[model samples]
Target: MSSSANNAVSSPFQLFDRTEWKRLNGHFSYHLSQDEVDNLHALNEPLNIKEIEDIYFPLAHLINIFIERTKDAHAVVNGFLNKHTQRLPFIIGIAGSVAVGKSTTARVLQKVLSMLPGKPRVDLVTTDGFLYPNKVLNERNILNRKGFPESYDTKLLLNFLSAMKSGVEEIQVPVYSHLEYDILENHMQDVVRPDILIVEGINVLQVNSSKGNIVFVSDYFDYSIYVDADEKDIMDWYVSRFESLRATSFQNPESYFHRYAGMDPQESLAMATNIWNEINRPNLQENILPTRYRADLILEKGSHHFVKQIKVRKI
Candidate 1:
C-alpha cells in the first residue's frame, strides 16, 4: 500500500486519543510519591506504569475537563435562576460484562483520582447496593437470576443519585453483603458531597422509561466507560477469578461461597461456568453490552486481560 493510501484507512483498534499519544517508556512522571506507588503495587495485581500512563492518565485528564464544564454549567444555571451556587459531584459510570475488570478500573480510578489536586473527596459506589434483598427476589421468583434490571430498586437508586448531583449534603446508600448475597438490614453507607462519584455495575447505563421515573439514568453520568472483550475471553476470566477466590476468599467458613470450596477444581469450574452462562452472560448480552456506544469511552481488552484499545466517543 502507498503511504498516502494507508492514511485513508484507519485501524478499528485505535484508542480515543491515539493522535499525539505517547506511551511511557518504563516509568511515568506521575504526581504520586514513591511510597504511594509501592502501596499501589502491593494491591497484589500486575498493574504497571504503562497501564497507568496509557489507559488511566488520559481518562483522568479528560475527566478533569468534564468537571470544569460541569462547574461552568452550574454557575450559569445558578446565575439565571437566582439560586445559591452549590458544588455538584461529577458522576462517572463504569460498565461491562461480568468479570471484565470494570471493578478493577473503578478501584484504580478511585485511588488515582482521589490524589489529584482539588478532587480530594472522590467516592466510588457500586449499583450492587441497590439490589433488592434476597428474600424479595426469592418471592418474586427471580432469585435464580439476580443481576437483571428487575432485581434492583431503580427508583431508590435514582433518588440517591439525584440528591447527590442536586447538591445534597449527605446521602445514605444501602449496604450489601457479598458473603450473604443480599442486602444487609440496618446497614447503610453515607456519602457527603464528594468531588467525584464513580458508579459501577452491569446495567447502570440501561434505560427504563416504562418505570414511574421515566428518565434515563445514564443521562446523569457526565462521562462513562464500557469495558469490552470477546465473550469467550470473559468466560475464561470468570472461571479463573472464581478459582482464585475459592482457594482464598471462599476458603473461610464464614464466606457465603465457602460451600464451593469443598468442590474439586473440575467441579468448581463447572459451577462457575454454569453461573456465567445461565445468569451473567444473559444479563450482559441483553442489557449491558448493547449500551457500549452510549459510553463516552470504551476499553477494549485482548485475551491477555490488557486493554488493547481505548475508544473515546467523539463529541
Candidate 2:
C-alpha cells in the first residue's frame, strides 16, 4: 500500500462490504447497527451489509450535510436579495426500478436521519399517492403499467412538491392504497412542512416540459438519489417479494390483491416474472434507469443486494 498505489483511481463500480464501508466518498454519513439496518431491511428484504455500508450510510450522511448547507445558502441569498430568509424543507428524491429496494432506502433514511443532530422533522411522501385512480389506469389500458410516470397526475404532484418546498406551513398529499392499488380519492394526508422532505417512487425524479405540459417534479429537489442494482437480481427479488406477499399480504381476505393468493406457486411465479419482464424491466431499462446519471448520487447494489459502488456527482 504505497502512497501512490493507495491513491490510485478506483472504478465507481467497486463492490463494498461492511468492513470496506468506511472508505466510501461522501461529504457526510453515519453508521447503523446490523440490527437496525436489518429492521429497516425487512421492509426491503434480501438486502445485505454491502448495501448498508456502501449504499445507505454514505448516502444518508451526504444528504444530512447538504440539508444543513442548503439552509445556510438560502439564508444568505435571502439576506442579500432583501427577501424573507424563511426556508422550506429540503427535498430528496429516491428513484429506482420496482423491487430494487427504493422503499427500504427511503425508510432507512427517514429513520437514521431522524436521529441526526437537528432532529430535523422528516416528512416522506411516496409518489404512489399521486397516481391516477385505478379507473383511469384501466381506461388508459395501462393497469399493468401503473408505475409508469404517465399514470400519475403530474401537474398535481409537481404542484404539491412545489408548495411543500415554498415554505408553506402545511400541505395535503393524497393517500394511496396498496390494497386497492389506487389513489383513494378525497383521502388526503396533511403534513406540516418539515425540515426535510423525502419523495420516493419509480419516477419521483421525472422532469419534462413539452407538449404544452410544464410539469417538472425534480425541479424542487435539493438533492436526489438513485438506487442501483443488476436487472437480473432485481427481477429475482421482485419475484421473491411476490411469493412473500402471496403467503402473507395477499392472503388477507379483504386484500385488493387477494386474487393472487390461491394460485399455485408456479402460476404465481409466472405471473410475477411475466409482469417484471413485460412491464417493470422495460421501464427500468428505458426510463427509470436512464435517470440514474441525473442523480446527485448513485448507489450501485451488488448481486447480494449490498451497496457496492457509490457514484457521487462532482461538485
* TM-scores, all models, native as reference: 0.87, 0.86
Clashing pairs in 1: 16-310
Candidate 2 Cα deviation (angstroms), residue 296: 0.8
Q: Which segments of candidate 2 are over 4 A away from where they belong?
A: 1-21, 24-39, 42-44, 47-55, 208-212
CA lDDT, every model vs. true structure = 0.79, 0.79
What would you estimate as the lDDT of candidate 2? 0.79
Per-residue lDDT of candidate 1, residues 104-163 (tens digit): 788778877775656569888998999999899989999887888899998888898888
